[model samples]
Target: MMRKFFLVVTTWLTVSTLFLGSMVMADTYWIDVREADEFATGHHPEAVNIPYESIGERIGEVTGEKHADIRVYCRSGKRSGVAKATLESLGFTQVINEGGVEDVLSKIAAEK
Candidate 1:
């Protein structure tokens, strides 16, 4: 009984580790939920702005067929938070709320 319990625990641990690791390895994309003008005012080089109000209608177009991890942001962070939840509800593997565009841009600038 002790041996079986140990084996089961080990198996469970291994499977959990692998599952978590794969989740961490998922691809991430920067999705800007700001308006076109805001997005144009210096954004992440690779970010795609679909705007918060338009996200539901444009999610499929922006996301494409391939699964991608998403980092969402807006002018004030509020929209991005909502967008993150929406993306999660829509089945995105990893949707990160990156807060406001200015904050993110500053962080990126600082990193360089």
Candidate 2:
């Protein structure tokens, strides 16, 4: 009986440790790398507008933390790809090109 109880306790501790490790909070930034006109039409609720062309110049205004998980999207995948590259060049650690507006919106909706 004592051996069984020890085994159960050990298993519980291992599972608890794994669960806690997986629960680490990482900040996420959703960005719309589209022009103002396109952004004005529609955008993800959690996304901030920062045009691809202006990314280099206005990156500070968009995100201060270089290590933050930045998710970017645009009208098409082209601009977001550029934005992702630019952010990476600027020392951003986790820049994700989440594709076009529709694709991103669908992804976000599915996550809910």
Per-residue lDDT of model 2, residues 57-108, tens digit only: 8888766777778899998899999999998998998899989999987877
Q: Tens-digit lDDT track for model 1 on 1-112?
A: 9999999999999999999978866656788998899888878898888988877778887665335777899988999988887776777756778898888989999999
Ten-residue region with minimum lDDT total, candidate 1? 61-70
Question: CA lDDT of each candidate?
Answer: 0.82, 0.87
Best-matching candidate per TM-score = 2
| All models, RMSD in angstroms | 5.1, 4.9
What is candidate 1's TM-score against the reference?
0.69
Error of 1 at 91 (Å): 1.6
Misplaced by over 4 Å in model 2 are 1-25
